[model samples]
Target chain A: MGIIDKVRKVSETVWEIPVTYKEGMRAPARIIATEKLVREITAVMDFQSAASRQWMWA
Target chain B: MDVGVGGVISPGGIGFDINCGMRLVITNLTSDDVRPYLKEIVDLLFQRVPAGVGSHGFLKISRQEFREVVEQGARWCVEHDYGWEEDLELTEESGCISGADAAKISERAIDRGYNQIGTLGGGNHYLEVQVARPEDVRDKELAAKFGITIPNQIVVMFHCGSRGFGHQVATDYLQIFLKVMESKYGIKVLDRELACAPFESPEGRDYFAAMKCGLNMSFANRQVILHRIREVFSEVFGRSAEDLGMRMIYDVAHNTAKLEKHTVDGKEKRLLVHRKGATRAFGPGQEEVAAPYRDIGQPVIIGGSMETGSYLLVGTSSGDQTFFSTAHGSGRTMSRTKARKLWHGKQLQRDLEARGIYIRSTSWAGLAEEAGAAYKDIDEVIEATELAGISKPVVRFTPIGNVKG
Candidate 1:
């Protein structure tokens, strides 16, 4: 499973997206209830993470 | 949320605009006095106080002067003749936070804030001329102490923050922490957005120092805006700000983390109190509260949605469980984009105007985005807040005239 599946949600309000999901992601990404407010924020983070990983590989 | 000492200090937790807050200025003028020249007054305020995105402010300070603003905060504005000396005493942190090392601020940060002082940045943030609705004053003694004895007494409240400078500071630090989180600190976070170092660590120390600069910058920003607001009032009323009793009620940051001493287990303990979208609701007898209001309590301004009336509340001793903190405002029930889709700015503007509330804005679309329906009912929220024993309402301020850009 890729990084998205590594999410370990502690509760409804908190979840941890682990480093194994994305390379060089030094830390996990925690999503609180507020993160669900706008999909755009998570989308931007995903795009940035992918771009940064590509750059690191390049 | 408790950020462990020397633990991670998340920029996300502290918020991007570090000390983004509100300022309340009291005036002796009444609704009757302002009714005659409401349009002219709001128009003059709109002309004087720059609002909206990419707005330039009055003071064009050099890089060095910018550093002074970060170091001295609102005191810098007072020293430069933008504010009076007494204003500082009424402000949270006395209008300045010490340990703000401007050196922690980047050249990029300086450039972003160099000319933005005195400008009210966009969205939700506004400059409103409100009148104390007589019947809404809960604690008559507290209201009187806050100079709100007379019904329809005028007051001005403006909300803004460190603007681009604070944004850049948060961005820069997040990157630095992300790079150093594992290597230097041997610390891992639950999220990259929660990137932080130990408070005692070099990175943590630097972040706090830089964050303090953002706090200071916000105070300076509000001070300059208040100066401009005073100018507008003075221009319209044909009286000096002093004669108009345009004194500061209080200024408090809704986003900030401070090392404050609070009682725990019946013993005073120092805690790294970080309040994002929350404010300090210090009860009576806290030495930090200004002398004039020391016996009363710290003033807490809860900004309701633009249409609904805002409130002036004071902390309660019962709020100790909350670390003397309370909700900053009525949280949004809907998104801005969604609100814009549901309401037309022109129609909303007309509807508000018909209610005797005169408002000026640069973008009607932005105005629509701040529709009253977008937020939770402020009255209900305030009732819940007081019922929670966090704070007690003092005076209800209904917006009569407001300016936005």
Candidate 2:
């Protein structure tokens, strides 16, 4: 499922992904962003996380 | 979300450039007064403030003094006559986060940081001269209160950080954290970069103290840069910085994790807020808000890409939802590499100069990478922040001169 589908809107600008989305999750991840910014922030975050993984074990 | 005393501290959370931040200085000169010397001013600033990769500063201090600088922060700069005493009053945390231990910083970090004070690093970092147009005043009362008086009032804004010193600090800690995160703490993560140690753990505490040194180093760096700016302007205008009304509006850090008191579940809790790519927008009446702005709110300087413009905003009482935080800047929508490929630095410089914005940079590649088009619409970002009630825009600053790194 997509991140937007996983996150439940908390407010007009805030979104939260429940801990149940992934195993070993301690708490929900709260993001403060507009609908448009969500795309930008998530895209960069995904790229960074993937690159971080490669750097970590390389 | 109570980190309480047992929260985990992630070096990744704060990023590599420990206290990458912004500082805005207001001046009494109007745009017309500065327009005549815009090129000269930008040229002198480009000369005085070292920029680009591996840039060293003019400050000459031994290892012992550098140790004291990290420990004392901007206060050391003030004591040494680099800035006015009032500058600290307007700075967040009085320009120094307490509990920074010099000994916590590695020698490698010291070697990198010792001479980097007052230097601007490359990649989206810049020293800009902006004008607060009369038409751009959103809140006239608040704008006047923040020192942006008169039409087309000139102000200097710069974005920089702890330089190589902070990078070394992060590198040193990231290596240590990676080793102990899983073996010592048994804390596994989705990504290895999420490596963290308990707040009270020896590694965590040491990193926290070391990070504060990075914070202080950045603060001191900006303070000295301000000093250079004041000198450059004084020479060009033949007036003292004070006589020219060069008062600092505020200085804020973008990458940091701080232990702060907040209301969670209607109960007071100490949370370790990791504000990466975010800024603290403490509301009015918060004790942490500077005294001059206590009746209003903390001045949040949202720096836009040099091509467009930036904004001066005030925190809102309604900012409690996201732990009283807001976006740091019009974040990059395009990668630096992608941007460099799309635009040439020299061409971009000529394009900006044609649009009435003076520009100078160490490299055209760096300049092109920071082309305004590469970032999100700053107006839209500010609108989002205001609509979300995190911060209220007071005035917008249009750049007339910029020294890009």
Candidate 3:
């Protein structure tokens, strides 16, 4: 799934990926960004890979 | 953004040279005092202050003396009569940043810096004369409070930095940081150019120290140029610089890493602030600001490309949101090669002269790259900063005569 799909929408510009959603996350992923930024972030798979790597620790 | 150190250097961060920068000096002179002999004043300044690549100043000192320049910064120049003792008080970090170890500087770096002091080194560096707006004249009461309007009514501005020495230092560290990042830190890379060692690592510390030396070197270099500019003014106008009110208002560094305390959450935290192509916009009441300006905010000098207008801004409290930072220049829109292909130096010079903007430079290629068309509209950038609540504009300055390096 795309990273955006995994994130819980908080506001038009903000999103939250709860710590419990990841396996080994040290902290929840809170993105203070615009809709455009969210779209841009999800377009890159590398962020998903990195996010998954951090999830391993959770 | 979380990848940490993206592959391509952000022109916003790396700039031309990692630390290429500028300093601003507020003079006490009025426009009238400078008008009668503006041509002669510019000529004298051009002769005294070396321009172009590989340019050297009148001062010749030993390696040991040069080391002192790197370590002591503008203090070294003040001791040698290049600047006044009070001048240091107005400079960032009092014109000196600690941890500069001359021994760490490479031979080539030293060679490049040896004679370049006091020079207006080539590419983007320039000396400008400007006047405050008419509104400021009506608000003399307010202007006097901030030392904004001077007696002679003209502000002398210059943009330059450590020159070749700084470039070499950045080059040296980039190589070392790259090797250390891989061999010792186990950091797998993206772009080789974004090479870095951990902030607290040994290699990182070494680079920081060397960068301080670069910072100090530029301070001393500018300090010396200030003296030369004073001499030129005195000789051309037949009046001492002091009589012409050539007092320094303030000087600030554009590129450098600094350690500062700021509110991170609810409490204050100290963080290493790296401002590459950004200038610090410390708000009023901050202890770091000079006492005279403490109530009014730190002066933010934004130099435009030679063909455009420059601006004087003030740091707003809201800037704390962005780590007290703002954009440095117009930001280049074209590479040097592309600019040269599009514009001819002589034609550009003629065009500027027609517009009543005088320009003097050593290289045609340098002039072309600095064409106003080669950069973003400075007014728009400043406007964006204001809209973003990053900075507040105080006054706008249009250049009369320019000495390009």
Candidate 4:
């Protein structure tokens, strides 16, 4: 499954993927976006792999 | 998200352009007052403010002075008469983060950025003139406090960053981190761009100090640009910026990681907040907020595509859920390459002009890349942030004039 598939809705405008989704992740990754935004964001380019990787916990 | 004090510091988290930010300036003039000269104002601004890729600033300063510029940030600009002293207070971190150390910067970075102040770089960077219609004010009292009292009030907003200097800083440190991440630090990363060092490590501390230089440089750049904007308005309207009521609303950086104290599980601890494509949105009564806005909240400027409009928002106490951070802009829905293929810049310009927006661009291709359809709906993003209680909208500003880099 893609990163988007693993993303769980945390709030009306927030979504998250736990550390289990990707190895080496120190903490869960969160996105502050609406459902529409989340869909659009994840479907575009390499956001699921490359760009989303950059969004990992610092 | 809170990267606790003991957490790592990733240069990638801050992005290439350190301290990329938005600045809003409110003017006493109304849309009616500026309508007659919209084209003239945009043309003059385009000519005066350097824009586009590799654009050099008009200012001539020695390398030593450039070091001071990066270290002191906007304060250096005000000291050199490029801005008003009061402009500093309205800026984030009073326009100068205290920890910036020019000594930590690479010589190569210095060479790239020393002459880049007062410039708007290419790729989605722009200077726009907007107006706040009476109906656009979501909160009349709040909007009035932000200098949007009169109907159709004119305001100037711009988005840019530390230019090449910031990029070089990130590049320099990324390479160093790559060398040390696995070998010396025993840290593994998925991508090279994700290279990082421990926050307490020497390499990380050095990068942090160097990054501050880039942060300060961006503030200085915006300060100088604001000065030029004031000059252009004065020249065109035949009145001083002060007489024209051209005062700054606020300057907020969207990128950069900083150490901040926050309560987690009922204990206050320092967390290194890394806000990439996100903005700090401290709510009311925050001591870090400017004195004038401390009672209300820090002003947040959200830039939309040139074709659509932008927003003036304020932070909310409820933003603590995300460490007091909010979305930076209408995140792109389509890639620049795809957008360029979809829109013709010349035709887009004409269409926008017919709708009462005047635009000047450095390149047609660049202009096409920033087409409104290229980005997600800004109104939707604002509504989401509002529903999430991260930020509260004060007013919306429609673009009347724009200079795209």
Candidate 5:
């Protein structure tokens, strides 16, 4: 699945990424944040190339 | 809470100054009585009380006598007529904690503590004049119980510590603990600032004793300052301290370690309680609380930055969960260097004067370090603690004047 498809919606302000989706994962990734806050938070991250690489792998 | 030998030094454990603390005193005078000479009174205090970094008090003593002051705490001050015997009852640990061995304290610590007995050191150390809130005045039952009655009754609140003495003690032990950490005890540390040994170890015992000496030294220092304050009031107003009703409310230490029994996991256990940047907020009926304040619980004095409002809170039973602890003051929001860089001392003083808050300080840089804007909203922090069931607010006090060190 694509990176976006792998992200599971948990609540209005929360999201979860399953550990099984990654090979070296130790625990599920949990993010507690509003959509706007998440967008602002992600804007500071270097995620474009990583997301493209993940999509290519899928 | 357990610091097995070789733990890293965490700032949260020892804090900036090892035993920085606060003391609250309630007076019977009404606001109107003090209002007329508020400026003069603050001026007199600034003149009579030694302040700023490395300030020395009027009294001088031999190293042996100074060691006795550290060993006996406020009791030594009381014996020397700096304060009354009744004041001891209101202080935590009755003003003196056992195990203050002069031998455990270093010569450098002794030298630093000698002349600083009644001095108010720099940084956040301050003396303030405050009036109880109207709501507290209306609650006659509670007011009567806490000795706070009559609207606009003046109270004195100050925060200080053992000065250079406490710093040296913490410094000396931090080095000693660091040396023993790798060689004697193979313990890894996450932070060097949190350096500590096991509670039962010899090194731990020595540090604890020295720490108690620092605690005692602070109490005695404040006790002496209280006497000087009384003398200043008498000189300015032509009335004795008793005539002015300058009675001590309570004195509590913020940074120190003590062996306390608390219920953990549904079982009672003795734990070494280290309250760094925190105060004990024991609930009502706790034997540790003073007799008169037992029903109301221990008084928790939360001093705000000079420009903000301070608060008087009471401990609740819920505090048992956190070893009866609460935040000591409004936590700093900005670094001191940042505050000093952002604001000028003269401009800050002018702003405070505009709000009718009189201020006197020894150093302009010290004043900048304590700018109210440098701290978090005290009201919000107190609310958070109340919501978390650690303490309950009793009354809010807005500062009319302040003396900074």
Candidate 6:
């Protein structure tokens, strides 16, 4: 699965990426950003691969 | 939010103000003494001390002198006769934080800071002439030790920071890390805006060094402003500031990251502690607390809005668990936009004057955004911190005259 597919919403303005969605993960990572901001956030974040994915957490 | 080891240092962690913090000075003169010339004193201070966004400062120094300001911090101002030598001793880190490398700072940062020294940048920063009451004196000896001899002891308190210099430094480093974080280090971030490098990485070391310059710049900035306050008082009172017994109580910075030694699990460890809105409140007997104040603990200044009052607090032993830190100011209860929507600046200014609070601000809209009601009650915040055993209250100062940016 793509990194974006692993994203989940925990609350408004907060998103979580579950540990099970990725290898060698111990805990989920959370951020203070909305789903819409997720794409805008990646223009610089996805330096290793060219990718885009959108998943509805709500 | 804890950033892990080798994690990047985001400019957002400390914000643009850098070492933006508060400085409190206690005077021998009483409210009665100043009230007669209160208007004149405030007016002169408002003129002598520059406020507002992007305002130029009084001192016009050479580029070499400017570099010294960053390298020597507050000491640069004192050596140049800006403030008394005693003022330096009372200030944390003696106004100079080691590890500051002016060479590490970007040229753009230099340009922004060169003419902006000694200024109170816009957005809620202020210099106020206040009166402390005896009724609110939490510890009489502590207050006395702090040079507050009586109720109505006229005091001057101001809040400011590194100004545009720090803003430029944060911007420069953030951009640098954004480019190198994933490419060179293979680091993945939770937020794109939260770009950072390892604390020991080449990028991290350079940023840290640059950050120290920003801290020192803030120290020098406040030291110069304090000197101006003394000058204004000396002129208004017809005596030297020293003759008036006007001396600095203390100065504290609320932002920045410091590598400090702390005891954990009964073992001493050094950790990089970053406090954005919190300040060092080292309790009594701690070596880091200033010399004269070592027995009493570090001074914790909690600045409130114009209408509300501010407090002077001392660190306590019980606060060690939280790295001996406490709140820096009366936390905002309403956002700036919300407060502006609630009231007009002109009306708020008139209302504050009616209540005996004199205000001189660069912009009325800026003043409205800083409405006292928009902040958490300072008295209550102090009370809670005291009850929580993090800090002990020293004195409560109500503003009589204010100058804001």
Model no. 6, DockQ? 0.04
lDDT of each: 0.81, 0.88, 0.72, 0.90, 0.78, 0.81
Indicate the residue-level lDDT of B251 in model 1: 92
Real contacts recovered, all predictions: 0.00, 0.17, 0.00, 0.62, 0.00, 0.00
Task: Classify candidate 2 by CAPRI docking class.
Answer: acceptable
The CAPRI classification for model 6 reads as incorrect
Cα lDDT of model 5 by residue, A3-22, tens digit: 44666776654456676765
lDDT of 4 by residue, B252-299 (tens): 997799989999999998888888888999999999998899999999
Instruction: Flag the better candidate by lDDT, 5 or 6.
Output: 6
Per-residue accuracy of model 6 over B298-397 as CA lDDT, tens digit each: 9999898889899999999988666777778876666688889998888987898888888888888899899988876677667656765778898899
> lDDT tens string, model 2, B1-405?
246656888888888888899999999999999999999999999999999889999999998999999989999999999999999998888998999999998898999989899999898789999999999999999998988878999999999999999999888998999999889988888776677889888999999999999999999999999999999999999998889999999999888889899888888998888877678999999998999999899999999999889999999999998788888889888998999999998998899999999999999898989999899889988987898899999999999999988
- Predicted candidate 5 versus true structure: per-residue lDDT over B174-250, tens digit per residue: 88888886687665554555556766678877888888898999999889999988898888789889988888888
DockQ, candidate 3, comes to 0.06
Candidate 1 regions exceeding 4 Å error are: A1-58, B1-5, B265-268
lDDT of 3 by residue, B146-168 (tens): 46654435777898888888888
Going through the candidates in order, their DockQ values are 0.05, 0.27, 0.06, 0.59, 0.04, 0.04
Answer with 2 or 6, whichever has the higher lDDT: 2
List model 1 lDDT by residue over B21-75, tens digit each: 9899999988999999999999988988889887888798799989999999999
**Error at B222, model 1, angstroms:** 0.9
lDDT of 4 by residue, A1-58 (tens): 4557878898878888777866767677777777887777667634545544535431
Q: Please, what is the TM-score per model? A: 0.86, 0.95, 0.82, 0.96, 0.85, 0.86
Pick the TM-score winner. 4
What TM-score does chain B get in every candidate? 0.97, 0.99, 0.91, 0.99, 0.95, 0.97
lDDT score, residue B144, model 1? 86
Kindly report which residue stretches of model 2 are placed more than 4 angstroms away from their true locations once superposed.
A5-7, A18-25, A42-58
Docking class of 1: incorrect
TM-score of chain A of each: 0.50, 0.65, 0.64, 0.72, 0.54, 0.57
Q: Candidate 1: give the TM-score of chain A.
A: 0.50
